[model samples]
Target: MVKHIWDSDRAAKLPKGVEELVYRSNLIGSDRTVCNWGGGNTSMKTTEKDFRGREIEVMWVKGSGSDLATMKTHNFTGLKLDDIRPLIKRDQMPDEEMVDYLSHCMIDSKHPRPSIETLLHAFLPYKHVDHTHPDAIISICCADNGKQIAEDIYGNRFVWVPYVRPGFTLSKMIAEGVANNPHAELVLMEKHGLVTWGETSETCYQKTISIIQEAEQYVNDRINQHEVFGGKRYQPLPEDKRKQILAGIMPVIRGAVSEEKKMILSYDDHDDVLEFVNSVQAPALSQIGAACPDHLVHTKRVPLYIDWNPETQDVHKLADLIKSGVETFTSEYQAYFTRNQQDGDQIFESAPRVILIPGIGMVNTGKSYAMSKVSGALYRRAIAVMKGATALGQFVSLHENESYHVEYWPLELYKLTLAPPEAEFSRKVALITGGAGGIG
Candidate 1:
């Protein structure tokens, strides 16, 4: 369980502690086990002076793709609450148009757009609000008996919310849930995560910590009682040890997973990565949708898992097996897109971003090294929650259609088109003599 790191002595000197909120946001967002990179959002409701020196209500929400660990006040956009509040009553809006409207609501259009969850934070009647996708909360939220489990642990303190598609739909559901139980301490979104609020930043942050601690303990107790043999953290092989596993096998898998662009591989064998690769259910659970809806944009709906054990598998024949596996994964992904894609859905690259090896651990691939790392990190985060959820009950991930919708979300898909193309290096050569012959 993670503890709240707040310093009152220092907070007294800062202006409104917006800086303190930024500090807390980084603490929560940076913890991979708590919330993967950019997987969650946080906000604070406060008064700010506009250009005319007029006092105006403003809510600052984390910007898209901003890593909370390093986020500054500039990374959060302050939207005029007066403009945002009106959105609560507007019955329906397209996701893309809604994002446009949110951008328009910004007090400073120059600032990055506020999160889609901006409205959810604005709807709540609190001074400080923090939202996260902690694995401990996930264990309870995604359990087979999620509601009852939450009620058993939280009683009347939390209001259990059923899963609804995120964005305005979720914001609306939250609005209703809040109105129904004004005194509720927390809100548990089934198949999602937890939400908590308070008058002060410390209260809200501490409450979040306490909730997760209880849930973590609950899962651990259940595992011990049933003798379920909770998962272990696998030791990563050293660089020398990894040479045989990845050296000769990478080109084969990378080349096979391509059409026009070659794939770059990111390898890891950390505890989280190993937990998934070594799990009894890696093949079954890794194929289920993303850990959270927010992860779809980064990790895709599923990771491609290949069954190769470096310790005993035949090294010479590894290339053949990998080629077949990549082909199978590609065909299956294309079929998934064809069957599930809507009329206006744009086609995406069919290659897998993440891959799992039996003894070698996991490898995530991308067009670039950084993207491959992000892909691997997210899948590893997803698997952590799945492992924790198993201890409580049968782990449940998002449904197939739900996963498809999020991965192809119109507003989200539009953002993909906006990314700058990767920089290219052109060929330039100079004739040079061998070391023995070259002279100035």
Candidate 2:
């Protein structure tokens, strides 16, 4: 894994905080291995005078969907430090309410929502903070004995934090750990990622790169040339046949998942998809849950798997299989919802947003084309993460119970409600019998 640190010669001209942070952010963000798109968050805590001219400590944290690699000053949300302290001390706060608390603290009324991890960055007693779900680090973090491995490797150099859903409680847990071991420079959140902070932004960024490098070394030394990788990398439907294949099958999936409006479908036919589908362990490992915590919203839990062989299966036969797979997926989703839903919540659409067809490629559906693409990207990353995890050991992720909690989290559901309701398709359907071949 390559680590890109700030380079004075290459730095772009901008305000100090924004320039330095953005420079540092892109250095890592540019490398998907360290932080893929918006998967990580960064911050700097500094004192800025309020409108009354009295200086107040405030945190500038990465905002929602802000790609660190391409971030600007406006991409961060600035919140008063004092406002965050009260939140940290609270024993509990619902995730959605926590979002409200963060929004309430934003110094600028127009700032987009801060990251869900805003509190986490604010509560830590450090001038600068950086968190990333580096694939190498995550490979180790997700191990069954991940914490033990972390401890054996870093000892007192880093504080090993067990997996906790990222929220106010997680921030509190991290704060307590830091207090107990004041000298620690890094904290590893098992099955999540790494958090490093320092008195300077450069320090935090550098430390993050260094620690992840160490993790890379550890994994390389252990899994070196294990011949653990074995699979025939298959190509998706020939490029020429791709359009025909999708046209034949996507309608069935869209109709199955759509309640009142159309659901957009995304198909993947990249070489990597073929490799994962044809892999020896495809059956055992692809069933795991979303690649990362935030991915739960974009990709949902596990994807529906449709077993097919392009060499032998005809297009018509494959369409029927895809339809059957979606039906089973929706039914399973219904059962899952029935078993886990709280009294007030209702069941969601039966559509399997993420689909894996062995002979084709990965598929995803969303309310819109953009969202479908986002899910597609996340699923591709999921494939990479899963491949890495299985090579090391059996792949396991947040339990089905955890997936349920996140999938149904009020905040995530709230996002869906923000989109305009699907247009009424009922108005478009017609009997059409009398005008045409007619049996009115």
Candidate 3:
């Protein structure tokens, strides 16, 4: 179960309103079980003075590209609530037009762009709102019988929203759902995440924590009752042997996938990772696609799984297998792009972000060490989600077309452009041969 870590004394030090919202956001985001890095958003509706010194209702939301755990006052974008609230009344709004419309709603032109789900926060009739992709909740959300499980867990306390890509339409649907169900205390987006709100920040934060704990307990209870991931099929090799194998194979796998852009590779052999990769269901489950939409941008639609026999195959054989697997993955990815491409849509890199080796571990690739680590962490969460969902029933991933759309979504892609330009040695690894006197 996810522990409730709210500290009243800590929260009391901060001002009430936006600062409290940031504190609440950080608390929720601090736990990977509650939300993955940059996977969730929070908002607070407060009255603020405009340029004319006249107070107007403003919605302060987590900005685009900002992570909840590390964000501050400047990381939030403030917008006039009166301006964006009216958007909820529209019958339909296109994605492009919605972006344009939201830019005009900013309370200060200098503030960063509001989150893509700003409208969802604005439309809800609450002062504090939180939308998080909690692993416990997502486990239930991604199951084939997700809706029925959710109902069993929470009954009608939370409103169940069918899968809808996050945008104007989804925002509107959530608002209508809340409006229609006055008794509902929370909103659960199918195959997505959980949404909670309150008149006070503490109330809001506590509600989010309590609900997740309930779901976590439910999943834990059920998971303990069954053989997870259909019980492990292969045993992990000794630690020394695993490391030796990784040292030999990392470069070959890295070189194979880095044809277009150089990449840094990070390896993981945690008990969970080893358990999943060595499981009977690893190949079928890993190929199904991402467990959540937020994971798409970081981990890609699906990870490439190398079908090599660890005991029978040498590093040379594994290298050849990596080449063959990557080729197949690239071809499949290109076909996916072709099938889902729109007029203005451009394809992202065809290389897979994650690779799983049976009886070995998982390898995550990115432009830098930090990014590679993040990819590994997120995929680990995906593994956890898959385990829980499958333990409950068959795990269901996001649709292929939906995965393509998210991978190419302009708004999602825009976050990548927000980072500062990489340094000269950005993607290059360096070694200091002589630590005591390197210059000598």
Candidate 4:
């Protein structure tokens, strides 16, 4: 279960409002169990002076593409609440128009872009609001019987919202749900995450933690009763053997997947990774789709799983198998893109960001070390979500069409443009022999 780390003494040191909101966001985001990196957002509404020196209500929200764990005051965008709240009455707002309208509401043009869910935070009548994609909450949200499970767990304290892509419509639906159920304390967006609010930042943060704890306890109680991944079908090889095998086959796998662009590879053989990859269910589970929509941007819609018998197959045979797997994955990915392509959509590389190898572990591919490491970490979280959901009931992943839309969403892709252009050595590895002398 996620720990309750809120410190009253420490919180007392910070001034209330956005300062308190940042403290709460950092506390929740520090725990990966509470939310994936860059996957959740927090906000607070406060009265602040405008350019005209008049006090005006403003909503300070986490900036787009910012990680909650490391954000500061400057990382949040403050928008005039009066300008934003009126939009709740609109029957519908196109995502593009909504984004444009939001820009117009910013208190300062220099603040970063407001999060995609800024409207949700503004529409809800609360001083403090938090929306997080906790693993435990998502496990219940991603199960086939998720709605029923939610009803059993929280009764009427939380409102269940059917799956809706994040934007104006979802924000409206959630507002209406809460308006109808005035006493609801939390909002659960199906196949999405949790939203909690309170009159104070501390109240909102504690409520978020308490709700996730309940969900975690519920999953933990039932997980052991069910066979894990239908009982692991294979055991990991010895550490020395696993590393030797990877050393020989890593280059081969890398070469095959880097046809479009060079990629750095990150390998993980953690116990949990081995447990999943060696299971009878890994291939099928990995192919279904991402457990959460947030994972699609980093890990892709699905990973490429290489079926290899570690005990019976040598490194050469494993290399051959990776080659075949890459060929098949590339073709299937291309087909997925062809089927889902829209007028303005540009196809991403057909290669998979993640690859699963039985008796070995998982390998993530990216343009840099940090990127590859993040992919591996997020995929590990997906593994955890899969385990918990399957234990509770049938695990339900995002549909292929929905997955494609998120993976190629224009707004999401825009985040990449914010980074500086790559340098000459952006993806190259260099060994500097004089590093100790500072010259390197």
- lDDT (10s digit) by residue, model 4, range 261-317: 888889999998999999989989888889888889889889999889887888898
Measured by lDDT, the strongest candidate is 4
Q: What lDDT score goes with residue 440 in model 2?
A: 44
Candidate 3 per-residue lDDT over residues 214-233, each given as its tens digit = 89888999999998888877
Tens-place lDDT per residue, model 1, 33-62, is 677676677888889899999999988888
lDDT of each: 0.75, 0.75, 0.89, 0.90
Displacement of the residue 225 alpha carbon in candidate 2, Å: 2.6
| TM, every model | 0.89, 0.85, 0.97, 0.97
Instruction: Please state the error at residue 41 of candidate 3 in Å.
Output: 0.4
Model 3 global lDDT (CA atoms, 0 to 1): 0.89
lDDT of 2 by residue, 1-440 (tens): 65646665565464656557767777777877787655789988888988899999888888776777788888888898898887766789988788877778988978768877887888788888998888777776667667667776788877777778878888888888888895687888866778888787667777888888887777766655554336553445676686777777777767766753457777777776777776666766667666677677777787887777777888888878877887788788888888888878776666777887766677788777777887887777777666556556655688887888878877556545645666655213335556664454
TM-score, candidate number 1: 0.89
Off by over 4 Å in 2: 10-12, 96-104, 220-224, 227-260, 413-440
Q: List the residue pairs that clash in candidate 3.
A: none
TM-score pick, better of 1 and 4: 4
CA displacement after TM-score superposition, residue 274 of candidate 3 (Å): 0.7
Candidate 4 segments whose C-alpha is farther than 4 A from its true place: 432-440
